[model samples]
Target: MHLREVRSNQFKLLLIALLIILCMALAYRLLIVRKNLKIAQQADELQEQKSHLLEQQMALDSLSRQLKVAQQDNQEELRQKQSEYNQKAQEVELLKQQYIQQRQYLLRESTIYKKIQKSVSTPNPDHKELLTDKDWKAIYKCIDTMYPSLSERLVLAGITPTEKKYCYLSFFQLDSKLEAFLLNVNIDTPYKNRTRIRQKLKITGSEEKLYEHLALWG
Candidate 1:
C-alpha cells in the first residue's frame, strides 16, 4: 500500500508538468499573432501617409505651372504696352515739330503784311497843298487810277506842290516774276540834305537799289 501511494503522487507531479508546458506554448502563439497584427497596422498607416504626400506634391506642381504661365503672360503684355507707348511718343514728337514750323511761317507772313501797311499809311506832302477836301479827293483819284493797288504808298512817298520841283518819279520792276511795279520818288535838294535823305532810305532789296539810283541822280 505505501508503494502504491508513492506511485500515485509521482503520477500527479507528471500531469502538473504537462499542464505548465501546454500553457507556455499557447502564450507564445498568442504573442506572435498580436505582434503580426501590430506590424500590419503600421504598414497600412505608412502607405496612407505616402499617398497623402503624393497628392500634395501633385497639387503643388500644378500650382507652380499655373504661376509660371501667368508670369509669362504678364511679361508679354508689358512688352506690347511698351512698344505701343514708344510709337505714340514718336508720333507726338513729329507733330510738335510740324506745328513749330507752321507757326514760324505764319509769323513771317504777318510781318510782311505789317510792313506793307505801314508804307501805305504815311502822309503825302502833295495833299497838304490841296487843302480843299474835293481837290484832295480828285488828286487821290488820279493817283489810284495811275497806280491801282499802290496809290496810297505813292501819295505817302512825296507828292505835294512844295515837292513838285524837287521830286522825280520812276517805276521799278521786281525779279519775283510777279506783274507788280514799285513806284519810286526821289527828293533832290541841297547836296548835303539829299545825302542824308538817301542814307535814311537805304533799305533792303529793290528799294535799296532804287534809293542808290536816285542818290546818283542827285
Candidate 2:
C-alpha cells in the first residue's frame, strides 16, 4: 500500500508540472503580442508626424512664393509712381518757362523799356556790317513772310548801313503808327522799282537789347 500511494503522488506531481509549463508558455505569448502591438502603435504615430511635417513644409513654400509676388507688385507700383512724378515735374518746369517768357514779353512791350535798352546805332569793332545783296534778299523774304499786309503796300526804297549794327531802310509813307519801329526785314522782293518817298530805319537786336526799331522817315 505504501508503494501504491507513492506511485499515485508521483503521477499528481507530473500533472502539476505540466500545468505550470502550459501557464508559463501562455504568459510569454501574451507578453510578445503586447510588445508587437506597442511597436505598431509607435510606427503609426511616427507616420502621422511625418505627414504633418510634409504639410507644414508645403505651406511654408506656398507662403514664400506669395510673399515674393507681393514684393514684386509693390516694387512695380513704386516705379509707376516715380515715373508719374517725373512727368509732373517736367510739366511744371515747362509751365514756369512759359510764364517767364510771357512776363518778359509784357515788360518789353512797355514804352519805358526803351530807356533801359542798349542802342545799336554805335559801331562794333568785333563785327562788320551785315550788309550785302544777300542780306537785302533775306530782309525782303522776312518782310513778305512776317508782314504780309504791308508787303503789297510798300517796296524796298534803299538800304544804307548806318553803322555795323544798324541799317536804314526807307519805304513809302503809310497812315499807320509811324512812331513805332518796324524791324521785320525782307530784301528779297520781286519789286525792284524805286519809290520817291523815302524813310530811314534803325533796328537793333544785339547790344544786350531785345529787338528794337526806330523809324526816321516822313
- Candidate lDDT scores, in order, read 0.42, 0.40
Candidate 2 on 1-218: residue-level lDDT in tens?
99999999999999999999999999999988886576456445534544454465565555555555555678776565555555555655565455434334433432223321322333334443334465555444432322233433323434433221122232212112221222223332211211112222222233421121321111
* Candidate 1 residue-wise lDDT, 46-149, digit = tens: 34544454465565555555555555678776565555555555655565455434333332333232343343355554533213344335333332322233
Instruction: Give the lDDT of residue 31 in candidate 1.
Output: 85
Q: Which ranges in model 1 have alpha carbons more than 4 Å from their true place?
A: 73-218
Indicate which candidate wins on TM-score.
2
Candidate number achieving the greatest lDDT relative to the actual structure: 1
Poorest lDDT segment (10 consecutive residues) of candidate 2 = 209-218
Total clashes for model 1:
2
Residue pairs in collision within model 2: 136-187, 137-188, 139-185, 139-186, 139-187, 140-186, 140-187, 140-188
- lDDT for 161 in candidate 1 is 40
Report residue 168 deviation for candidate 1 (angstroms): 99
